[model samples]
Target: MEKEHKHHISSYFAHGTVLVTLLVLTVITVVVAGLKLGPLSVFVALIIASIKGTTVLTYFMHLKYDKPIYRIMVFGVFLLFALIIGITFIDYVFR
Candidate 1:
């Protein structure tokens, strides 16, 4: 017996909104790059990039409509990645 998969169809307006939001984020990234924030600039850029990546994953990739377990797994993976990066950053700072 095969289980039926329910498809979540996103509206055109919603996609358009997402596109506009991404464009706005890109603009913000450009603006941030032009500023001389020094060490904080990289952190800010990473934050913005993360937001953009999440937006793409959630809407464009239809991860938002996936099962809860899948979402939790993705979150865990991201957390692990962050932890590794944090550790690497700490090591670099101390060296």
Candidate 2:
């Protein structure tokens, strides 16, 4: 007979932390959407939205508790995205 070992990979969060964060982010999004920041507003909104999205995905999706491979996958996705963004900027700025 073989002994099996179990590990706890999940996190137990304090209740409503996510809900509160969501409400706050929603308010920020709405408020920022209403304000006019000229050409920079779009960029700001996207950045802020990304932050909110990351928070949701990381915490809600339990990405934080995933295996190392999951982390690598996320890094790879972001790295590819960053490469594309960097290339676009370089091309735009140099042109």
Candidate 3:
């Protein structure tokens, strides 16, 4: 007989908290966008977006309770994407 694995169940409060945090972040993003910081506006937006994405991935996606391998894979993908974006930015700058 195979042993059944138990999954970690997140509480309703935790989900509510995450939802509130995401909502607050969304408001901040909108406020930042309205600031008209020129080139910095995009950078600020990206930073805020990345934070929101991480929060969603960690809590809502249940990555926080997953195995270490899954975390590593997600991080690797994020890094690869960042690297590609960096390279593209560099190419654009040089052009």
Candidate 4:
């Protein structure tokens, strides 16, 4: 398969989008942290971080057009991690 040519213009847009998203999410995280959401605060922060990570991986890391299996694998990894986190959270909260 032929490699697609990446245009400089698109790169600018992607960079800008990533920057804006980072700033917006960072602000949100800070605000949420100050709101005292109880145990859910950690989960909310993690969810935001996950979104940022996936944005970086899918766009900056060029995984958006990767194979279907690759996408599935990446999603599966996130889900597995989330489940583990959930279990630990449940244990801690119930303790």
RMSD of each: 1.8, 4.1, 2.3, 3.9
How do the residues 1-95 of candidate 2 rate in per-residue lDDT, one tens digit apiece? 64554544443463268767878888988898889888888888888788877887777776766666777899799999989999999989999
The prediction achieving the highest TM-score against the true structure is 3
- Which residue ranges in model 1 land beyond 4 Å of their true spot? none
Supply the global lDDT for candidate 3: 0.93
Q: lDDT order of candidates, best first?
A: 3, 1, 4, 2
Instruction: Write model 3 residue lDDT over 1-95, tens digit each, in one string.
Output: 65555788999999999999999999999999999999999999999999999999999899999887789999999999989999999989999
Predict model 2's lDDT versus the native. 0.77
Return the lDDT, model 3, position 7: 83
Q: TM-score of each candidate?
A: 0.87, 0.72, 0.90, 0.68
Instruction: Indicate the worst ten consecutive residues by lDDT in candidate 1.
Output: 1-10
Report residue 3 deviation for candidate 2 (angstroms).
13
| Deviation in Å, model 3, residue 75 alpha carbon | 0.4
Better by lDDT, candidate 4 or 3? 3
Per-residue C-alpha lDDT of model 4 across residues 1-95, encoded as one tens digit per residue: 76666632337878889989988999999999999999999989989998889888887766776666768888899899879988999989999
Error of 2 at 34 (Å): 2.0
Model 4, runs deviating above 4 Å: 1-10, 83-95
Screening candidate 4 with a backbone cut-off below 3 angstroms (N, C-alpha, C), the clashing residue pairs are: none
* Model 3 residue 49 distance off true place after TM-score fit, in angstroms: 0.6
